[model samples]
Target: MRLICPNCGAQYEVPEDVIPQDGRDVQCSNCGDTWFQPSTQMMAEEAEARAATPPPATEAGSVDAAHTREDALQEPPQDAWPSAPEPEPAAAEEHWHEDPDAPAPGTPPAAPPEPEADPAPAKRRLDPEISRVLREEAMREEALRSGRDSLETQPELGLEDLPEDEAARRARQSEERVARMQGLDPAPQAHAAPLDRDRLDPQPGSRRGLLPNIEDVATNAPGETKPATPPPADAPAPPARKRGFSRGFLLVILLMALAILVYSNAAMIAESLPQADPYLSSYVAWVDQWRLWLDAQAQALAAE
Candidate 1:
């Protein structure tokens, strides 16, 4: 039997029994078009019915028409006519026919197997020594908690059970331990003597002089004798020598005096000496400015 694709007019030579009597959906190998195809028996019956029907009347004088009809009748039936051999089914079409779910040709390849869902990450196992250490730490923590709870519930020592002095000593020791841990100095002992107010204040009979008496503070060693008589109060006191200015001081004073004289007469010097006029003029201007500043300072001070 011959089948023709309605969409692309591609023909396939299939077995007569390939299509059932009830008809079935068929797909085109060339165009991938699908449509319901009637059975060969039903198609033959339809053709026979079409042939039994009469043709419309025509003019009897039309000889060419009559001759064409006669020739068509004399010719073999369309089923007996030789047809061109069909090419072998393509690999893709054969595969598609074998497996309906197979993808069509020219489609993108299946999405790379969805990356296999990255497989659930395997659980990591801890080292044996690490696990042991962890367990030991947990047990130690549990024991510490238990011990702390018992300590919290235990009765405290009373004054009768522990002496006040001993308790104070223990508290001081604990405080010192904590201070040492924190890099601090421990407190001084309570037995240390406090500063005496009497010692800080002068005695009633003591003299209120700017300089203290050295004789009172001095102590004589054992077996040491005191001098029988003190030195006479004004027994020929040595003549006091006077201090004079040093040579450098005198030089500095002389230089200062010369500078003052030159500064005071700078304008007159510039007029008298033409060679030194420029230098003296600059010096005189500087001196005049200094004098004006000094005068302004003096006036401000007087006003204040």
Candidate 2:
């Protein structure tokens, strides 16, 4: 049987039994076009039906019938054959078609709506007293921080506030103090002139000069002066030491006095304080035992 592709007019030859009685789909090897091909039996039946039809009376009708026969023999029109049913649309596509707001096919999808920002968390109300305390604490901390920053920023010893000469003198004095603390002698100044020992000596009656006393200079180096220590103030006489019994000694004395009192007034104690009766009886038993032991020792000595 011969099969013709309607799309590209390409033809293929195959066995008659390859197609079913109804029809079978066949593809063109040259153009890759697929179409249904009727079986040889069905084609034969169709041809017989066409032949049985009455002949056309007019010449033009006969000519048209001949052309139709030629067309059927070459390639049948696609409309004459039953077409495959179309596939059903997807559920979502069907819904989209029903919705009026759906965008037309090939149109870009609308941008997704931005998420709404969450509402700001509500501030918790605080007690007036607590708020005031917190505010004051914050202010105090801020003041302390500012004070520390100022202290760090400002020059130590307030050198910026002093005259240049005074500042230099103070710096030198600080250096000297540090050197002394470290048990080091201060370095001599390059600019200072050497001191004249003879001129520096103080006269007997005149007021003391700018230079230190001769004895002090003799004891120490010329450039270095020992820091004068303040006189020791008379310490207040130490608080009078109160002579008193120590806690343990006083406790022992109190215990001895209590024992004597209990022993002398055992009967009165038992009558006055009923709670002391049991303790009094135990103490009396202990005393009696001790006396008996002493009597036994005396007897042993007499026997020896």
Candidate 3:
């Protein structure tokens, strides 16, 4: 094969070993111009191949051309085509089948036309009064959107003066109220109509579901209790326990022997009784009562 550099008009012979007869690239060493070359030998081979293979319209017959070349190179199946036809050489044109995803080489893209500059938003032709009104409107909107537009100082706590227990109780109440509002348990039942205050407040002395009052639960006079001016709110509540009672049962067992002293000793005598006597009956009755007590205890446990 041969190549001619158009710029330098120098011709270079292509290495036959590298230049396959099929369409391939050949570069002019002088000008570095690259062009495609297709030889006559390749065309003849292609024609002979076409004669051996099935029609290209069939799915199996339309395999890659590169694979056909591989078969010729590796084994060159005798019954298969000996050669293939080459296409006309293609010139190194300025344009190619460009991938849509790529930008063209060396051409500045249209500058997107600068969006026509928008004329600087007309320079805001407002008088001072209008400008002030717009500024105030914007500020008002911002404040409304962000309720915490201004910073707030936290409530100051005094180590010596602040009432710790009261503060913690209030905090707990606030958190629970927030949780209730956000649909957490124990959720306040929504009413079809506004509920009366009486429904929400507990009756005096009723401890059904209400937690014990802190002052009452302290169970000791504030003055008498010198642990701290206020007990640590985070401290465990004094182990609230009620005295419990346990009961045990015992059976009265008695054994007796009688002797008749002849004369008036013929009255009456109780002999040996069977194992299943009144003693067994009494034991069974005691067990039944104990079982009833256990059942009551179980019910109490479940309620707790």
Candidate 4:
């Protein structure tokens, strides 16, 4: 029914059922100490045991009916009649034994009554500074929790700045969206008519898109009202400059003249360089040998 904090000696009254048989953890309001409080079941059992134990008889008159009958049988009172009617057999049998409820003659009386429990003290109010600090701490914790939850659930912001081309693409997408909402195309596509088969060249394939359309090739469609664009009068005819020989052609001509000059004066040229004489003679001998070999092969083929 009551609990006391060991640290602060503060008392608390709690219902019997509030504590289970296994005990419960309780915090002291005064000292803020937490401890396991024993269950009240054991206390309740002790109270029941005390209630079952009968009180001791203090006065002779206070003796039980069985004790009075026994005393009456053993010693008759002087004023009482000698021939008092005897109790009924059943009553006599019932009063034959001493009262089991009464204590023995030399036994002590019941235990002294327990002293009244003291009233629980009133809780002291917290200091103003402490209260303010606790309040601020609670507010800070709540704010931190809320901020953390928001950070977890809130989506991160993607790149807000975009390149010019990306911005243009997004603009186009928005325009297309607006157009779709209004039941219109954002970019209308041109539908080209099929060209007539008769106008296409016979040599070209019969496929529809194989040859270029006559209107497209001519740069103007028939029946168009726009006048033909005449050539600009200020544009002069292209000049007809005479063709000139490239450096490579002139180099080839020079090489040919050198070859002619060297051939006409071959002996003099070989005499001027002794190394040239051996090379020239070897080349002529090789050409003559090739000619003889070709003639012999021709004659052998004829004989065959």
Winning model by TM-score? 2
Best by lDDT: 2
Q: How many angstroms is residue 48 displaced in model 4 relative to the true structure, after the best TM-score fit?
A: 99
Quality of model 2 by C-alpha lDDT: 0.73
* Clash-forming residue pairs, model 2: none
TM-score of each: 0.20, 0.22, 0.13, 0.18
53-151 per-residue lDDT for model 2 (tens digits) = 886679778898999999889985567678897767785576663668778899999999999999999999999999999999999999999998888
Cα misplacement distance, residue 151 of candidate 1 (Å):
51
| Global fold similarity of model 3 (TM-score) | 0.13
Better of 1 and 3 by TM-score: 1
Candidate 1: regions farther than 4 A off: 1-245
Residue 207 local lDDT, model 3: 31
List, residue by residue over 50-88, the lDDT tens digit for candidate 3: 999866565555566667877879984475656776654
Q: Name the better of 2 and 3 by TM-score.
A: 2
Q: How would you encode candidate 4's per-residue C-alpha lDDT over 229-266 as one tens digit per residue?
A: 89999999999865566767888999979866765666
- CA displacement after TM-score superposition, residue 231 of candidate 3 (Å): 99
TM-score computed on alpha carbons, candidate 2: 0.22
List the lowest-lDDT window of 10 residues for candidate 2.
Answer: 190-199
